[model samples]
Target: MDEQQCWEIIEAARDDAGQAWDHLDERLEHTLTRHLVKLSPPEVARFAEFFRALQHRVNREDLFMAAFLIHHGCDDDGFGDFRAGLVGLGRDWYTRALQDPDVLAEHPAVRARADISALMLAGFRYAPERALEELTGEEYDGYYDSGEPVRLDDPPPQAAPVPRRLEKLAALFPRQQAYLRELYPQLTE
Candidate 1:
């Protein structure tokens, strides 16, 4: 998809918020996947590199807040956190952020807004599978398109504790709990 088309889809999804998947008639997922497939190898590599770097910066506190915000569908504030945390972090900081996200958390505002939990959740949701598909030039057999019973591999153990805040939110919102379980099955265990 062209930049304009991409932005249009993104805007539409943002407008729909948590229900973007259903509101966009499911075209959003396919469009995104198609766009990913269109990217060159180097571009895809860079994308994967960025996620790995960002993942490295995330701390336990950040993860807790992220999961809380995402489970509650707090997109506006979440977007703010992402922009403020990453916008000015140059290429070098990207490398450093992976080692010590503390630098990104230096500004209290940035720390307050950047939801590393949500970022981590999103990364787990899409990045790895996309990267694998992009690099291998083969589609995963998982039913991403059909929304059927997609096969899931065993999830890695979670090192961090599931915060009480997130536990309460999950209890209140079963859908979010289900979503979280889909991404991090260990949460259920």
Candidate 2:
């Protein structure tokens, strides 16, 4: 979809509430994903750069928390805040998320789960050093074999702090917390 069409969908969703909002949000995400898949290599590179730049400005923890909320059906105020954050960042973030939903996997909550983490890592062209640090040297090698220069024996990087908002959201949604714990026992610790 063109930029104008994308914005129009976003604008419509911004004012919508209840089921309408959910439908619109899904529609917006679908369109953005479609657009992302159709981009040329140069366009993909530009989008990736734009995504990285925007990532620096936003609370990535919050974004991941928002993704969890959206994923688990917590679509009230939290969804609104998450949607606003995406809209504020413009279409690039949407495109980036479509390109690599694992971008959200940077959050510790996401990393705690092996299945989710694996899926996220698969989206990445380059192995995320922090994510793989916990793995054995053999495990890392098995996961990614680009043959590029990388040190597998180094210590895993320190984890990023989980944002207060993410914590609060988790606390507020006990079901989500339970779901996470069920899938990833480490999250409860």
Candidate 3:
């Protein structure tokens, strides 16, 4: 019914208590909580309808985002990394995310996805392992590896490399132009 009540269901679901299952407001928080705890097939089915109703025109996304920040703000490491990221999300993140085709492919909730991802990245930058408060010149050597699943303050990807000269070279043409890509199974789409 309310945020507090919804939160209880979330925490209960996270722990798999199954006691507060009824309290969850058709919101799928309970289902998501279950998914986070242990993803099951049936729960996955429920998420379709749930998220459809749950994430619409940024309103629900904002609510869900706020709740997530409240519930999981502290990422066990006792750092406010996530909080800082969410609050500090800027235009650059939004702009970069817009350029990503896969990001644009996420229809209906495109804006929400962009917002969430930007926040997540910025927050990860503040994480305990290697916070990129201010990157050094050496650290900015075309690559800023935070050494984690998330990138810290690395700038967005540059223009894809153009194989001009390599493509023109008859000898190197076959070897350079999409050669390794075709050769390696993983490299090919």
lDDT of each: 0.39, 0.39, 0.28
Candidate 2 lDDT by residue in tens digits, 1-189: 233543444344333322232233344344444444454433433443333333333334444544564356433444444434445334544445434433544433334542222212112221122123333223343233333332222232333444323454465456776665565454344
Provide the TM-score for each candidate, comma-separated.
Answer: 0.32, 0.31, 0.18
Stretches off by above 4 angstroms in model 3 are 1-74, 77-79, 90-110, 122-189
Query: In terms of TM-score, which candidate is stronger, 1 or 3?
Result: 1
Clashes of 1: 0
Steric clash pairs (candidate 2): none
Sort by TM-score, top down from the best: 1, 2, 3
Native-structure RMSD, model 1 = 13.1
Clashing pairs in 1: none
Candidate that beats the other on TM-score, 1 or 2, i.e. the better one: 1
TM-score of candidate 2 relative to the true fold: 0.31
Stretches > 4 Å off in candidate 1: 1-29, 65-124, 131-189
Look at candidate 3 and tell me the lDDT of residue 16: 51
Query: Which residue pairs does candidate 3 place in steric collision?
Result: none
lDDT comparing candidate 2 with the true structure? 0.39
Pick out the ten consecutive residues of candidate 1 with the lowest summed lDDT: 146-155
